[model samples]
Target: MAQAEGTYDEAQIRAEYADLTRELIARGLQVSTMESATSGQIASLITDTEGASAVLRGAYVTYCNEAKVKCGVPAEVIRAHTVYSTQTAEAMARACRRSYAANIGIGVTGTMGNVDSANPAASTPGEVYFAICTGAGSDARGEKNHSFHVHLAPQPSRLMYKLAVAKEVRDRLVVLLAEAAA
Candidate 1:
């Protein structure tokens, strides 16, 4: 049980997230999140670092269609694009961004492991969508809008898939956050 001495402890401090958090703080940029399939994992990771409050104020877990709508994701976007589509994710990002008026907004929605019964026709297992909207033009990351979708390979378990997706977002955010100073 104690094989690796200093390699994999219970600290669970993801270097990338911590670095991203530091960068955001250094640049005086703030971030907010709206999440679905990945839940609050992205937000959770971002705040893992010290002084994260300087950059991250709050986040939302819109696990259901109603929750997403209640949190500000427009009803029309969900109806037209379905909660699992990139449009919905973009809506989530923009909504959270406006909600907190933060420089960055992170929105993620998807079917992690199961077909969504609420919208089964559009749900594809392991398929997810996420968007990052920034006020880069106004002294933040350059691109005002960025979006991504991924189909996780059939594998280990639900936890693994979620971790994979969270890491995916973290990696992409690293790229985006790096542009803050540029």
Candidate 2:
């Protein structure tokens, strides 16, 4: 958390995700991801370490609107709030949690560094939306925890943006885990 925005190196970001993976494994919690702008990078990172199979149930790369809809994100959600909004992110998380039966589900969507050609009016460069839906909250849909929108500083590369988002998710998840344990 000490690191400044957009300044985390690849190694630091890897450690964040790897560390979070270990924490989840330790807690015997299953995790799944439905990713967009970050693609499947976070899922890939979670599976990089040993014992990942024990915790990572599945992942979906919902990079396009159709893919998101087909993967369980309601088409109506996208129609009401563009693919990059917090609503879509939350829906992605809840939908994946239900589909994969994971204890925790992560969703991410955003424009990397430029307006989206496919939806320019809704695009905001360096803006990201992410949500963490956990079993902790038994809403009508059984997914509740946290969701956020972030405007990242311009990084040197797109990879850094992805890492920044990963770090945010990891950091938030850690707190939520701690809170749940308490």
Q: Which candidate is the best by lDDT?
A: 2
Model 1: per-residue Cα lDDT over 58-84, one tens digit each? 799998899999999899999998888
Write the residue-wise lDDT of candidate 2 on 93-125 in tens digits. 988887888899899998888899998999988
> What TM-scores do the predictions have?
0.85, 0.93
Which pairs, if any, clash in model 2?
Answer: none
After superposing candidate 2 on the true structure, give the runs of residues whose Cα lies further than 4 Å from its correct spot.
Answer: 1-4, 136-141
lDDT of all predictions: 0.80, 0.85
* Count of backbone collisions in candidate 2: 0
